[model samples]
Target: MMQLEQFYCRNYRIGPSESDFRSMYRPSAMLEHMQLAADGDLNAMGISTSEMLEQGLGWMLLATDLSILHPARLDEEVSLFTWSKGSKGVLWLRDFILTNHEGDRIAEARTSWALIDLQKRKPLRPSAMPVEVKAYPEHSLGDIPEKIILPEGRQTRETDRFTARYSSTDSNGHMNNARYADLCCDNLTPVELAAGIRRLQISYYREVHMFEQVIIERTDAADGIIWFRGMAADERGTVFEAKLQLNGAA
Candidate 1:
């Protein structure tokens, strides 16, 4: 049986600023909270990120599948619960739930990650991890597909191009993972942004370093469903791809 102590929990308050004048928490912000809870969980266990870095190991996110049940309002206190869902082959999985102060679930996510060797920049198998985490078997989003596939023969449009700024880079010296949602969403029609995001799935293919340029494109596949791909301006291939599902017709 899974014990309560095995999961990690943290609380946070929504800020005054919000997404698209809707006073709703943005996907990017939710992602930031997710990262915080994951790090805090490991940190409390005496395996902090810096410590892992010193050992030439670090966590890298490959994909995330999230669902926003209800929009988190501004200035509200919320609790985030996370757990290490264990590792399989080269992928380590984790799951999370965001709840209001009332204990009602508002959001949940499933993610796939890799523990990469800092020096070699390659993913290590679960058994090869220097540190061990007791993983539980609960899956909040059920099974996440091993891959995120964009629509075949999908139409694409070049929407915008920009360089990764200093503020956008994280400790890995690459564009912060959370920032990709904003990069893709920024290309959406204002109506779509205002409609609010109900679900989002993203896959990271490569890293974008500080000051490196990226080209973003958009393709709408179905009603309330939009896909985006960010490619390296220098032709390093796709940096990331995302699919956003809006709440309703907008």
Candidate 2:
């Protein structure tokens, strides 16, 4: 059983405004919440890129699935509870629950990470991080949720592309995982689509490293569902997959 550390955060006024429903809550903001929570865990583990590698382990960005329950407004003093669920060998899991001051649930999210050898990029065993940081109480453990399925890939109907930059990649030397969600949302036709996001899932097939070109592909899987795939066109095929659910609202 893994014991999770609780994080209490005060919501700020810098979040997305109420101009429209789609932009009601930016994926970037949610990503920020996840980043903060992960940072806290890493600090608790006393594991940095250099420190972890000394123990025959390095960090690898994996995947994230976020579900929104309510909109967190700017400057709204909300509490975000985060904790590490479990880790099997090299793979690590973290869960988060965002709530208001009154104990109302706002959003829930889960992300996957891996610790690997810095030189060869191979996974390391569980004894890498310190025992206290790695050991988490399991009595209140929540079930790991499933990632959304990408129905299919489709030929892109639009010609817009986001320019790749070096800053997008994190310490793992790959494009920051959260930015992929932004790329998928950037491709949306704002005029035609009018809905709030309920769920988002992304699977990383390959890594998009520094100075690489990435192409965004979209798929319409039927009514009320859509899929987006991103690929690094240098030599490798696809790199990542993104799926989103948007509700049509007036």
lDDT, candidate 2, 172-216, per-residue tens: 567777778778777767742445576777877667777788777
- The candidate maximizing lDDT is 1
Put down candidate 1 lDDT per residue, 137-242, tens digits, no spaces. Answer: 6644578534666779889899999799988998887888899988977887877877788988899999888899999988964788888899899998988888
lDDT of each: 0.84, 0.64
Candidate 2 matches the true fold with a TM-score of 0.79
lDDT for model 1, please.
0.84
Which candidate's TM-score is highest?
A: 1
Candidate 2: pairs in clash: 2-136, 2-137, 3-136, 3-137, 12-74, 12-75, 13-74, 13-75
Give candidate 2's root-mean-square deviation (CA, Å): 4.1
Q: Model 1, stretches more than 4 Å misplaced?
A: 1-6, 17-20
TM-score of each: 0.93, 0.79
| Clashing residue pairs found in predicted model 1 | none
